[model samples]
Target: MFPGTEAQEETLMMELSRLVQEQVQGSSWWELRGKDCAILGLAFVALAPGFLLLRSSSLLLFSLGLLLLGVSHAAITVKGAHLSSHSSLTRSPLLNRIWAVFFIEVCGAFSADAGVQAHIKMHHAHTNVLGLGDSSTWKVPGLSRSLYLFIAPLAVPVITPLVALAQLKHQPLLSSLRTLLMVSLGLWSHFWILVHVSEFGSTLSALGCMFVTRNFFSLPYIHVNIFQHIGLSMFSPEQRPKRIYQMSHGVLNLPRNLLLDWTFGHSLISCHIEHHLFPKLSDNMCLKVKPIVSRFLALKSLPYQQDSYLSRLRLFFDQYQELMVLAPPITELVGIQ
Candidate 1:
């Protein structure tokens, strides 16, 4: 929908490239590795305090434990697992795979292989093409707005393992069994940690703590996931725009939420548009490149969509019938217009 003929598109890309080069470069190999290690180390540091606090008899101490544990979970899965899935944390595939196994499968309770395929291969590749990267994964039309946004997210901890198990049907037997074993090991080890380190009175107490801590950040997690993509321009396959236009039109950046920023990274929050344009960049790099991307898009008369999280929450609540309960109408973008 931005003004340009097909021939002008190449110039747009080149212009953007020049602008990018003028900006800061991407993360170095060593920096990415170090970044990954630092985040993992921080998660463990928080986890130690979390476990210790959980063992205290005071209600305030138990609540502190829940908060620390939630932050640790977010660090591992939201930041570590997401970056690893994109191969943004390392150059070597073996290193990326090992990191993914630990962060995505073991700590995050999802199949690493399935995550990469679903996210990078499909979602990122198909940004807002309907039924692809449209954030359809968060939809539940049957639920009312209150339940869909507020209540349903509480089941995320339970749903994650089930979804991981279900993806097994799509993989080869060896991969499935391996994923199954890793997931089981992760769940079992976490349960053991709760009982041994946290000093919960019984298996039930451990389970309850797990449920509470895991779901602590679920509301924001779900909110941020959907707010970035849903209600944006959706394209049918035949009428899809070119890559730049499509992503610009469909993707949105939410004003940074510190909790989400630390947990989910700038890729999923403040620099989402830049992340879509350059998926391989590290979170810090994405934040670094964001200004250049935004300026170039502005100069080119292309969209640089952004809105606040609460505004989006309000929008969804007001327009739930159209945005969630039914399929939004496919937008026919005039290419090279």
Candidate 2:
């Protein structure tokens, strides 16, 4: 676990000094293009294999197809949609929104409306607050911790959009209408292929497997999400500071993990501090900036939290009780404070 601290005014100067040194002296257009292409390239790779797998008539082939579909979808959800929504993967509003639909709705079978609501609105704003932030989704006031971890991820995806819809119906007319249209379209497309597309085959087992595969992806997707933010420092609304402080304080950047970081980009776990600090920076840019960010934190004698994937995974499960059930004692609130 990382230690939290308060920075003196002079300390802030040192942190920023390292941040400047770490940046790619100057940004360029190609750097941005390269990242956008990488994101699209990965998307196509994930999607093409699934299409090929689905075309096969054999059950074994189809099962493999479903696995591919789930893995690709997970990558989009974590790597593509999550980062794009934050505008951390690209700059174009049009491109980010398009990726948003492809990832949140089409691939992940989740609504962009709810994802924004939970992630950008609630989670980013409140962070680890008791009931306001999306972190609360993992909490089970009275239930056993093990059961909560198992069920929370499975339940959130199904219920989050509905919660978003209900919350927005009377709020913004335009936003509400757009959300409804997007959600309806997304659900329609998913069911249409599963139920009516004859080529995909219509069978109880096939349909069951589709759902089962979707559910299976949820575990890791949720694990990464929770592991990145839940067990970290948090602060109340009243204690929150400037946007930069709020972002840089609580968030920690774990070391790059091979498969997970590649799929989810540096923003998922690695360079996470930079992502929170500068949401507009592309994933590649975040990776480029990590050394600067780490040095800044380190010079200030702060822990830029990082751990091996296995170690973090173990910590999550081991501390599930305190993180989700009992809640950590408010020792040193970081970002929001």
Candidate 3:
């Protein structure tokens, strides 16, 4: 039972959301299925050069290739694969999971099972709940604004997986085992390729360099996932209304940067409001649905949180002192009120 008879208000909001969705004929901004294909196709193109670069090239060329490969994987994993795997990118179950494996294991170099558990279960279920739903482990309390930004890139590959795996400690043994296997395979793939490259020269040195570069460039991908949701609202399950509010209020959409948007899909920024509303929407479809979502929220007198990229970057910097620092909310003094 919702208090204050806001039940009527909630109903009206839902109605408006439905009407706008109907206006768009239930399609999102673009061809949903087509975008998936385009994203995957481009990823494969990048992968080919990556494989060749590993086998035959100077260390400099090899490092650049690895860097590009990391970029490509981040784009495909976050944009192309994540939405589809969530079934937000498409309707086909078989195809969606297939892409999930390719992107999750091959490109993302992690476990699909782990990714799903951390992303869909914990993050979605208890977002920003301090130690519980915290996805921003890189944040340290009382650190200078500059320090957080500087060390953030180095923490991604090393820290994120450990945190994600910890979140899965309660999972069934079978599920956990499966995820670990996938993780191992992802690790082996990188090591194997690097070792093969080393056969041509100082393999040990090459391995060290590859490890450093591979993890370092992974920052952007890691940053997008955390910054999108962690700093936003953290509502109690009791007060939760519709999914729309959870997403719109709980998540902040970063400004549209063409290069980032094209690489990471709307999940990195756009479809989030729609995702919180309808988690099933694909990236391609989410854009189509954005107008509908915005109108619906507007009619209901709701706030749709969107900030410019630079603004968000600044916010992340400014709030560095409070980030990852457990603290209580502030209440106004008697006179101030």
The lDDT of model 3 is 0.62
How would you encode candidate 3's per-residue C-alpha lDDT over 1-337 as one tens digit per residue?
2222356656765786677557447444456567656776786687667756766558887777776676666677667657756865446778778777766755565567767766677776665554444574455666665655666567566665565477457668876676666666766776676667434356676556555645644556656665776567654433444444555556777766676776777756766776656566566666777777787778766678887766667767766545446542322112111
Supply candidate 1's per-residue lDDT for 121: 86
TM-score of candidate 2 on Cα atoms, chains taken together: 0.79
Question: In candidate 2, how many Å is residue 1 off?
Answer: 17
Deviating ranges (above 4 Å) for candidate 2: 1-30, 57-60, 98-102, 106-111, 129-134, 155-157, 168-171, 194-198, 203-206, 240-249, 333-337
Give per-residue CA lDDT, model 1, range 1-337, as digits (tens): 4566666876777777666655544546445456655766788899989988988889998888889999889878888888888787877878878988888898888998899888888888887778877778889988999999999999999999999999999999998998999999989988999999888789888998888877878998999888888889888765677677878888999987777877788889999998888787778777878888998888878889999988999999999999998988887776552
- CA shift at 287, candidate 1, in angstroms? 0.6
lDDT-wise, the better of 1 and 3 is 1
What does each candidate score in C-alpha RMSD? Answer: 1.9, 4.1, 4.7
Q: Model 2 scores what on Cα lDDT?
A: 0.64
Error of 3 at 251 (Å): 2.2
268: Cα error in model 2, Å:
1.2
Local distance difference test, candidate 1: 0.84
